[model samples]
Target chain A: MNGLLIAIKSETFIALRTFASKLIVAAPALVAAAQLLLVRLTEAGQQARDSLLGGSNFEADVANNAYGFFVDSLSTGLTMLGLLLVAQAAYSYSYERDIGSIRHILIRRVSRRSLLSAKLIHLHVLALLSVLLLLVSSYLLSGMLWEYSAIVEDGFELISESEIREEITLGIQLALLPLPAAIAFGLLISVSAQSATQAVSTALGITLAIDIFKGLLGGSGPLSLCEFPAFPDRPVLFTIRQSHSARLFRCIDR
Target chain B: MQALSVTGLNKKYGSFAVLDDLNLQIDKGSIHGLVGLNGSGKTTTIECILGLQEFNSGSITALGYPPPQLHLSKGRLVAIFDSPSLHPNLTVRQCLEHALLLCEKPKRSTEDVETLLGISRFRDFKIKNLSLGNKRRASIAQALLGDPEFIVLDEPFNGLDAEGVDDVLELIRTLNRDQGTTFLLCSHQLPYLEQICSHIAILHKGKISHSDTINNLLGNTQTILQLKTAETEAASKVLETISGAELIDIDTDGYLNIRISGADSIAINQAMVENKIPVAELILKRASLAGLFREITSEDA
Candidate 1:
């Protein structure tokens, strides 16, 4: 851990000035916000057509709940964040090595292990910031587009807003929990790969390939890709789906 | 005390050995040069010393620290690579600033180094945008951010204009003379290295075949006298009688190629005259850095 602080400061200095760090922090939120806006616009057009045709929507209340939309947005944003973090983590070290900048730090003020650890910490900080921003934007956008209310029928509440909030919080926690491990895997690839392009492509390709193939294994199979600690997005995907389905079922019960 | 030392170093790629029991020593305040032909393991040696590439077996200590723990030196040692190892996205000013952050006690400001390296106009330019020479300057600028006690440079003069070469040479001279900085410069530019380096290590095959002070090593090299004559047999006979002259070979044309070690060329010429060997032509060729390197490496082969 020698020169860890200096390495971190160097990392932070570059991250602050470079495009990659900013992309990691802002891209997920931007993508999620766009998705939410597009969904809202499409819903508005559908409602306009419904009114013109004089047809009534029966499941409108459930669809209009902000909590469900918020949960959905979190899922999409986290998915993007997960993939982005892995790709970025893979790129960071290998790119520096490719450019030969890492040699200076190694020779002057940082050990190899310290350099790697500093990168890990720096990427984690970036991932955390991205998740926070995504959460805030998603929450704000969903609230703006939909009502914050409990699922109710005949003036009797079937599911309380507080209960829905608890489920969404749990879902968010489970979905976001595997990100650090995913980033570590990306870093391992970064260290092992020869070039930045190879590192990034291998990291994302292996991660996504594993995720895609793991579905063929399915739950209760010998090789559960969803349960793989390194590839945690599958469980996260399941959590997002479960959250949405729970809210949908509450509305059906009402 | 030595500023850097490598002992019994061995490096290999698959079965081919790049370095075999290689040893080098750079004394404090001396500009040491590592000169060899291409693919003669100059870069490999540098990389092994800096911990950029691992050696199979050896011990390397720089500034009282092993290669793996070189960071413990904390800005006291630095290196400038052959390639411009700067952040391409960062402007020259920003790259310098980032390097400055790593310095424990900054001696020169980024502006100071920028102006010193004559890269002030390109300060705002990204490293990727700067020409190779300017990028090299910026890379050198970063190494000068602190008052490093030791500096290692690999192929330092590559892609530089004549002026750039002069500037870098002068910079190395000044640093060693004024600051008592130790240097380990690796390059094939023997004449430039001969101009600046106090000591030269000739890496041949996989080991240091010859290493000493530049004066001593060149002093030990044999001078050649290409003796053209009407009588090659007579010249050969006369050269055999000389104490320090050895007839190494006879060329296609009737000429006696002789090596004079610890002996004067005049003595051989005088011997030929006394023996009545008609010397048609006599050319004196003194051994040089290039000559010695070529001789030693050619011998190794």
Candidate 2:
């Protein structure tokens, strides 16, 4: 127990002073904010063209809902976060080993098992912080760009605000289930690989390969066990929006 | 008390033996030097002792703990490796502060070690930006933060300049004298080891061929006295009369090389003059660690 604590302290000391840890925590949030800004600019341009042509805004209610954009931004941020966590976890152990710094802690106060456990715990903490920031930034930016309300048509509510919130919540829960598994896979590669470069490249490569395999199987088969959490093809919110949008279009035709 | 002991240790890699039935014992509060050639298993032995790697069969103990359990000693054991094993991105001060986290009770502050190692000016410099010698200085500085009972240094003098070497040697002496700290240094620099080590162990062919105090090992080899004279036969006859001198051979340089055990050069030269032999040049070559090491290693070669 004492050895483990010392190892944690040592890991924290280096993490606080290093750049890689900061990169892992902040990069996802920054990228996600940039993505949301770009998306809003594109939407504004489209709205201008439609107004100039005097086109009918039949789908404007659904399109203008901030929930959809929030979910999209969350997906983008989560995808980047997942990759960053894996790469950082893979780099942490192997880089210390390559530099021979791990030997000092091993000989002085920490066992091999304790050192590895501390790293695992430290990476998980970074993941948690990154997720919190991603949630906050994406929620705030999406709300600023559009209104958070229900989908309505001609003074009659088609979808309630509570229903939209429920779908978005379900979609986010499904997207976050696979993150811990990703972090564990990265640590496993870190200990087994020979060098830091080899560990990172191999971990990222195997993760991407699994993602590709998951796609080829059409989200079915044993490959789904290692599914990429972000950017799911049919999130609950997207499915609900599509179903309602199609119903409204049919009503207009009638 | 023995600080470290390795008995009948055998380590083999894919049927190739790296260390075969090796045995060594280092007493507490003594600086022991392990010297060997490039391919010798010096580094491997240190790694196995530190529990960084496993050996096939061995019984090793350090500071009342096995290699795997050395960490339980709570910073009683430290090691400075050949390469500077520090984070390149961190400043020297930051690296020391990180090391302090592993120490159960640090004895010296970061500033103290930096000043002791003459690296106070480079405290804020990143390890990667420092010169190799300064990087090595920083590496040594971190090890001194804890009050270690036993320290292991591999190639401690590899990248140091002459002044840096002097500082390290002085530091080792001061620590050993003041705190009674033991050290096991593995290096190829024979002269530096001779200067600092109280005992020397020559690792040859996967085993310790010789292990003894410096005086005892060098005492086994006889000093050579070279004499140059126009009358080689007359000089040879006079040297035969000396009790402790045995004429080995007259080398191609026309100098009679005699191995003397107890006879001094003055006595030999005085006897040569009394015998009416005009000695042009008389040179006495004392036995050194290098000479004794050569004599031992060359025997098998």
Candidate 1 lDDT over residue span A1-254, tens digit each: 54898899999999998999999999989988898898899989988888898866548767777776676667678778888888998998999999889999988888888899999999999999998999999889988987788887777788788877776776677667678877898999999999999999999898878777766765443334223333445446454444455554456322
lDDT of 2 by residue, B209-265 (tens): 999998898889799999999999999999889989999999999999999988889
Distance from true location, Cα of A82 in model 1, Å: 0.5
Q: For candidate 2, lDDT tens digit of each residue in A62-98?
A: 7777776777677667777788878888898899999
Would you list the C-alpha lDDT of every candidate in the order shown? 0.85, 0.85
Per-model fnat list:
0.95, 0.95
Q: Which stretches of candidate 2 lie over 4 Å from their true place?
A: A216-254
**Model 2 fnat value:** 0.95
DockQ scores for all predicted structures? 0.78, 0.85
lDDT of 1: 0.85
Identify the candidate with maximal DockQ: 2
Residue pairs whose backbone atoms clash in candidate 1: none
- Structural similarity to truth (TM-score) of each candidate: 0.90, 0.94
